[model samples]
Structure formats: structure tokens, C-alpha cells
Target chain A: MKRYFWLASYPKSGNTWLRLFLESLSHEGATPDINAMAFSGGHAAVRDEFERLLDIESNDLTDEEITRARPRMYELEAQAANAPLLRKVHDAWELTPAGEPLFPIELTLGAIYLVRDPRDVAVSLAHHMRQSLDQAIERMSNPQAMMSMSKRFIPKQLPQRLTSWSGHVESWLEAPVGRLLLKYEDMLSDPEAHFGAAVRFLGIDADRDKIAAAVEAVAFERLRSEEKARGFVETPPGVEGFFRRGIAGGWRESLTPAQVTRIETDHAAVMRSLNYL
Target chain B: MQGDLTLCGWRVRSALALPDLLPWLGGDSPVDIDISFGAIPTPAEPPLYTLPHSTLWADGRFLLHLEQVGKFWVEKGRRIVLEPAEHADESELRTFLLGSVLGVLCHQRGLLPIHASAVRINGRAILIAGNSGVGKSTLAAALGARGHALVADDITAFDTPTAMLLPAFPMRKLSLDVLDRLALPHQGLIANRPGQPKFHVPAADGFAPAPLPPSAIYILHTDRLLKSCAIDRAAPAMAMALLDRMIYRRAVGMKIQPPPALFLGLSKLARIAPVYRLRRAEDPSLHRLDALAEQVEAHAAVTRPLLAGSGTE
Candidate 1:
């Protein structure tokens, strides 16, 4: 049985960038299309694939029912995969209503969790969700913050329960699946060391030269320029673009001091553990 | 109450009240399918396809185990055996029976079921196809509100021999936001299932009971960057591929060895009828719905004369 790994992170943490780097590694000598990346095609929250795999309509099922079905859904996906699969996930590590881990542990090879500073996340998340800075901060601190949980209309993707940023990091850290933690700030500071470590964790036999080539292939400047020339399909409807200022600590310039304090106070414990504080 | 019903041109004898289907008016015609309350038999061998609550056997049998609902066995496209759970909502039980089970039956009978919501405009059926929750129902409802009669919602089964699109249930499964968006009252509307915001809105005003020959197929494509609606006619090759993707329960349908007639029917349908890519903004505003309906109507009108002259049917 071919197991899968999750490129797991809260929204606006460098999940997409890391995924692009992996895509670049596989498709050497060419720039990977930002829209058609492997992980992008297989998001954990995509509703269509779930419905197809289970032979059931998701709209007919309640949120609780959908949650209960999710673990087995991934198991089926694992069985169907010809090679090791990688899925992008925004949902926090949690249990289904049946008390089973949502991403079946036996079918999971590991999770590459990308942790970004909550303060920075709030700044980037505001732009991504089209929310004000204050609203974004509140969502980051909200224990029940959920994406696509709207009962009014069915969003394209399934409901992703992203608890507060602190809770999100802790959940994945303590999950039963094998964990390879890579901080977003560290990746930006030293791409060679951090990204190379990630490739090795995935059991890929790549030297530093290949890893550096993949990293250089997806530099933030190239990605931003690419999004400018040809619009990115993943960009939200009203958002200007997805690759907005792919730099760390933008909160210093973009966020109000009070806003920073809010994220800090809410997530200080987790931040201190990760040496963020 | 026993349900002696007709669904998509089949005589159905059901134990549950499948109110969505019309009464079986073909008095003496032998029942084509049976839906009974009974024990669901387990498959003798390992399932060909297995999910959390459902499994499909190699012999073309399907079993669905809905938590707190019931266990369902759909076998040979002729019989459906259901064992209702304690206090299971009848409407909930009927919902899956009509949807997933019926879709499997369509495949078994060698019919082409497209994942679409279709409406009859200018005396012919126009299928609006897309993935789930792409506003297929909402768009069909909008067209229906514009005096077009609804042919089907969700699953539009195409009968290959007659080259006609058999209408499914005369009901639109709409979410609360859609009801609010269309200003439809949900006061007496029954939710498809308990705890789900979707309601089963009966299409009594102008429900097309008889199968209508399909005239055009519109595949809904929403792009965030797109500012307005753009309808483009797809080439023959692309149309065939896109229409294949629109097959209802396509994954499950693949488990069944489809007859050669299914492909031949699809090819003929694609060759004659126009398949259009109806591109619209991902976040279409209120007025966009009306504009979309107008564009579709105008396009259908323009193509009618051309189709009449071709004599391809």
C-alpha cells in the first residue's frame, strides 16, 4: 500500500512555496506551473474527489457525517495511488466525530508542517481572505476558526477546522503521524539547510546542489512575476494575487503594534516553544 | 405507504413515499424496479469498490450504510432492498435511494447520466453541467424563474435509443443561501435531511414530465479572474471529453463495464448538439445571474435555426 504525506499548514504559512519547490524537484529543468502543482490537485479539503472516491454526494451529508467519512476517504485514496501521494491541508490536526484521527494514521507516511509566525500570518491572511487586519487577527486567535464551514452555500472545498494558530501548531506537533517541522522563517533565511532536510525526510536521494536548484527555481521574485504575467488560478476571486510580499516579519511594517500584541498574547506559549518569542 | 411510481420513464414499486417521482400511470406494465423494506444481503466476495459507508461488489451490487439512517442494497438494476435504522428520517432514506442508488441503476441499464441540472427552453432540453455546488441548480432555478420549465435537477439521464433526456425528480435541492438569494420562501420546504441546510423545493410550477430531446449542453466554468459571463462553443473533440467528465457518479460508473452503446450515444449527442463552455466569475454578483440566463437564451435561439437545417438527428 502506497501511503501519503501531508503538506500541512494553517492558511498563509509557506505551504504553497514548499509545494512548488517539491514540484520543481520532480520536474527538473522547467518552471512548475503554480496552478497545476501535484499537491494543489490533491487538497485534503477538495469536495469533488471526496464525493468521487466515496460514491456519495457531499452536499447531502451533514458536516458531522462528512467528518466521520474523511478518514476512510483518505484510506481509499492511499489504496488507489500508484505512487506515494502528497496532499495539501489547511485543517488543523483533529479527530473526527467517531474519535478517529481525521487523516488515517496507518495510511499516512508523515506530515511536513510549515509554521509561520501568527503575527505575520495575520498580515498575509487578511490579504488572502479579503478581511481587514483586525478581523484576520481575531480569526487567528479564534479557537473555532473554520474555513468553508458556511451552511448557507456549499463552498467548493470541504470545511477545514483551523483552531487558533497556537492550537494548530500544537495539534500537528503531537499528532501520531511522523512529523518533520520546518519553520517558514528558517526556510527563508537558509533555504539550503531547511529544504534539503525536508527532501531527505521524504526519503528522496537528493544532494544539496539539487535542493539548491529547486529552491532557486521557485524564488519569490519569479513566482510574483509569474503571477503578474499570467493570473494564478488559485488566487481568490477578488484578491489581487496570491504571492503577496513573500517575506517574513512584514507585520512590523504592515501591522499596528496593538494587533501584534493580540497575536503575541494569544499564541505566546506556542511561539516561545518554537523560539518565535 | 407503498410507492407505485414512475421515475425517469421506469415503473418503480417502492416501500417508501418517493414523492419526487410521478405516480405509475402505466397501469398494467410490469414493474421495472422494486424498492422494498428488507434485510440487505452481504456480498459473497470482497467489494470491488469500498468507502466508509458504501461498497460496490464485482457482480454490480451496491451497499450503502448511512449512519443513523439505514443500510441499502442495490442489486442488478432491478431491486433495491433497504433496512431503515431506528427512527431514521424517511425523507433522508429516500434522498440517497433516489440519488446514488438510482444513478447506479442508470449505469446498469446503459443510460448516460450527466451531473447536471437541466431545464426546457423553447421546447427543448438544455443541460447545465458542472461539478457539485458549482451553482447548477441555482442557474437552472434562475432559468426556471425566467419562465423556462425545469426538466431535471442534479441527474439528467439520457436515453440513447431515443436520443432523449429523461427527466429525474421534479424537485430542486437548494441550500438556504440559494433560497434567500432567489427570494424563495423556505417556510414549508422540507430539508433533504435533518441538520442539513439544503431544502427539497418542489418544482410544481413548470415541471417537464416527458423526456425532451436535448438541444444544447452548457458546461459551467467559473474563473476568479473572469469579470463577466462568456459563452464559447466547444469544438467536437473537447465537447466529447468535457461531457464525459460530466457523467453522474462517474467513478462508480467506471466500475461497471459499460456497453459500447453508451460511447456511441455520447459521440452522436456531441456531434449533433452544441456543447458550450459557459464561463462566469467565481464570485458572480446578483445581476450576473439574470445576464447569464439572457446570454444562454440568446445563444440557444441563434443555434436553433442552424440545428434545424443540419438534419443530423
Candidate 2:
């Protein structure tokens, strides 16, 4: 049986970058083809997928009803899976309405949770959500933050309930299960060390040279060019670009001190523990 | 089994005298299907398709189990054996009966059912297709509000004989939020199912009982980037692909993996009727909908005569 793992993170964190790195290893090329990444056609919350698997209309289902059937959906995906699958997930590590973990441990082999500097995250999220820096910071600060909740039509994935960033990080960290955390800053500072560590943690035995090539292949410039040449599927309807500037601490130039202070204050403990400070 | 009825171009006999289906009563033609309020007899053959809640095997037999609600056995594309859970509400059983059970039955009979809402335009069928909750029913309701006859809601089946779309239930399912936005009354309507925000609005004002010949298929999409509505026609090749996607529960249908007849049927439909991509504004309202319906009407006025002259049928 093929094992399932989660490429899990809070949105705009290094989730996509990490996936590209993994795809580079899979493709074993000079540069990872941005379009050639092997995930399901999309992330974990696809409505059409749920309905297709369960043979029920997901839109007709209440949010709680979708949540109730979510674990079963994962199981079915595992059953139907032919290869080792790494499904992308943005939802906080949480439980379904039935009190089962939304992403069940029984179905999962492990997860790679990517955490980024909350300060830089504020700047990127502002652009991704099309909100002011202050508004994005406020949204991130709030424990009840969510995406695609105010949608006018059926969202592709089910509504992802992300309690605040602190809660999101802690939920995964606090859970005693197969989870490996990778700081985005670490990947930037030492791509070879961190990326290879992640690959080994996920239990893939690859040549060190090949792993180094995978890291080199997913450079920020190459990803942005690919998004420019062909639009990204995950790009929201009006977002200018999904592959925004992939620099850390660019937040210093963009975020007002007050905005930085707010994120720091909101997530101070997690920052210090994750060594973001 | 009791008195049988015909709706959505299928004859159905059921044990329950469902009030929702009362309006669609009195079809004495040869029984195309049956519904019994009891346990189903074992199929003479082993299950061809094994699933968690349902089992389908041997020439269109399906035993569907709706968790905590009901268990249904759709047999040989001709009979439905229903056993509702003790204390299962009317709303629960009917939701599956009208949606998936009937849809799979149609698929079993080698019919192509599209996930769309439809209305009669210029005395012909104009389909509004989209993913679930893409405002298919809302657009169909808005069109119906403009006095266009509502032909089908949710599942619109194709009749190969006439090369026309067969109308489904004479009701449009609208979310309560939309009903509030439109200021439509909800005094006597029933919620489609328990705990669901949507209600089944009976098509009392403008409902079409008979099947109408094909005219056009409008695939609906909402673009946040687009400031206004844009309707673009799909070329023939693209239209065929779109029709394949428009199949109701397409992934589930793949399990049965209908024969080439399904593709031939859908491709034939695509070749004759024009398919359009209608992208609308992010925030939809009655005014925007009025503009959209007008654009579609104007487009149809030009194309209907062209379609009639083609003589492909």
C-alpha cells in the first residue's frame, strides 16, 4: 500500500517552494517544471473530489457534514492511490465534527510542516489576499482567521478552518505524531542541509548530489518566471502573481514597525520557540 | 410497489406517496423503473462495483446506503428498493432519491445526465451548467423569475430519440441566502434537506412539463478579475470536452465506465448545439443577472434560426 504524507503549512509560507523542491527530486532535472509537480490536480479540500469519492454532492453538504466525511475521503484516496502521495494542506491540524483528526494518522505516513517568519508572512499574505498590510496583520492576529468562507459559490476545497497562526503552528507541533517541521529561513540560509533533511525525514533515499540539484533547480527566479510565462492554477482570480518575491526579511522594508510589532506580539511565543526572533 | 409516475423522462413506481412528487403524478406507460419500501432481493450475480455505501453490479443494479438515512437498491435500471432508516425524515430520503439515485439510474440506462439547470428559451432548451453551488439553480431561478419556463433543476437528462434535453423535477433548489437577496417569499417552500440552507422552490409559475429540443448549453463561471459579464462561445472541439466535464458526478460515472455509446451521445449533442462559456462578476445580484439573461437572450435570438436551418436533427 502506498503511504500518504502531507505537505502542510499556513498559506504563503514555504509550502509551494518545498513542493517544487520535492518535484525537482522526482523529475530529477536541471530545474523543476513548475507545471509538472505531482500533487492531486489540487490540494486536500477539493469539493469535486469529495463528491466524486463519496458519491455525494459536497456543495449540498453542510460544512460540518463535509468535515464528518473528510477522514473517509482521505482513506479512500489512500486506497485509490497508486504512488506515494504528498497532498498539500493549508488547514490547521484539527479534528473533524466526529472528533477524529481531519487528517487521520491511520491514513498518513508523516507530514512536513513549513513555518515562516510571521513578520514576512504578513507582507506576503497582504499581497496574496489583496488586503492592506494592516488588514492582513489583523486577520493573521485574530485566532478565528479563515479563507474562502465568504465565497459566493462552491469553493474548490472545503472551508479550511485555521485558528490563528500561533494556534496553527502549535496544533501540529503539539500533536504527538509523524510531523517534521522545516523553517523557511533555514531553507533559504542552507538549502542543501534543510531540504535534504526534509527528504530524509520523509524517508526517501536519494543521492546527495541529486538532492543538491533539486534545491538548485527551484530557485526563486525560475519559479517566478514560470508563473509569469504561464499563470498558476492556485492563483486566486485577481491575484497578480502567486510566486511573489521569495526573500526573507523583505518585510523590514515593507512592513511598518507597528505592523511588525503586532505580528511579533500576536505570535511572540511561537516566534521565539521556532527561533524566528 | 404502487402507482408509478413519470418525471425527468423516466417512469418510476414507488411505495411512498411522496408529496413533493404529487404534482408529477399519473404516468401509466410501461414501467421504466420501480421503487419499493423494503429490503431488496439479492442480485443473481455478484456485485460488479463495490463501494462503501452502495453496490452496483450486473446490468445497472445498485444498492445505495445513505448513512443513518436510508438504504436503496436500484436494480437492473428498472426497480428501486428503498428502506428508510427508522425515524429518518422525509427530507433526508428524498434528497438522495431525487439527486444521486435517479442520476445513477439514468447512467445505468446508458443516458447522459449533465449537472446543470435548464429553462425554455425561444421554445427550446437552454442549459445552464456549472459545478455544484456555481449558481446554476440561482441563474435558472433568475431566468424563471423573468417568466422563462423552468425545464429542469439539478439533473438534466438527455433523450437520444428526440435529441433533446429531458426536464428533471419541476423545482429549483435555492440557498436561503439567495432567496433573501432576491426577496422571494419562502412561506410555503420546503428545505431540500435537514440542516441545509437551501430550499426546493416549486416551479408553480413557469414550469415546462414536456421535453424541449436542444438549443444551447451555457457553462457558468464567476471571475473575480472580470468587472462585468462576458459570454464566449466554445469551438466544436472544446464544446465536446466541456460536455464530457458537464456529466453529473463524472468521477462516479467513471467507475461504471459506460461504453462508447456515452461519448457518442454527448459528442453528438455537442456537435449540433452550441456551448458557451459565461463568466460573470464576482458579486452576483439581480441587476447583474438581468444583464446576463438579456445577453443570453440576444445571443439565442441570433443563433436559434441558424440552428433551425441547419437540419442536423
Quote the chain B TM-score of every prediction. 0.92, 0.90
Candidate 1 structure quality by residue, lDDT tens digits, B1-313:
7558888878998888887777888779899998899888866688887767767897688887887788988888899998999988889898888788878888878888888988998888888999888889988988888888889899999877677888787889988877877788999888878867788998877798888878899999777667788888898889989988888877777776464666776776676578999988875345577777888888876665224313245
What's the residue-level lDDT of B228 in candidate 1? 83
iRMS, model 2 (angstroms): 3.9
- Pairs that clash in candidate 1: none
Best by TM-score: 1
Give all candidates' CA lDDT scores: 0.84, 0.77
Q: List all candidate RMSDs to the true structure.
A: 2.8, 4.6
**DockQ, 0 to 1 scale, candidate 1:** 0.59
Per-residue alpha-carbon lDDT of candidate 2 for residues B35-140, written as tens digits (9 for 90 to 100): 7777767877787777556677766667777666778777656778788888677677777788888788778777778888888988888888987767788888
Q: lDDT tens digits, residues A1-277, model 1?
A: 6988898999999998888898888776257787778633568988988887777888888788888889878888788789888899999999988999999888889999999988889989999989999999999889998998766778899888999899899999999889899999999999989989889888877777788888998899999998998888888877888999999888899988888888889898999999889
**Model 2, native contacts kept:** 0.20
| lDDT, model 2, position A149 | 68
Give the per-residue Cα lDDT of candidate 2 at A65.
68
On residues A87-168, what C-alpha lDDT tens digit does candidate 2 reach at each position? Answer: 8888888888678898888777888899999888888998998899999888887787876664334455677888788888
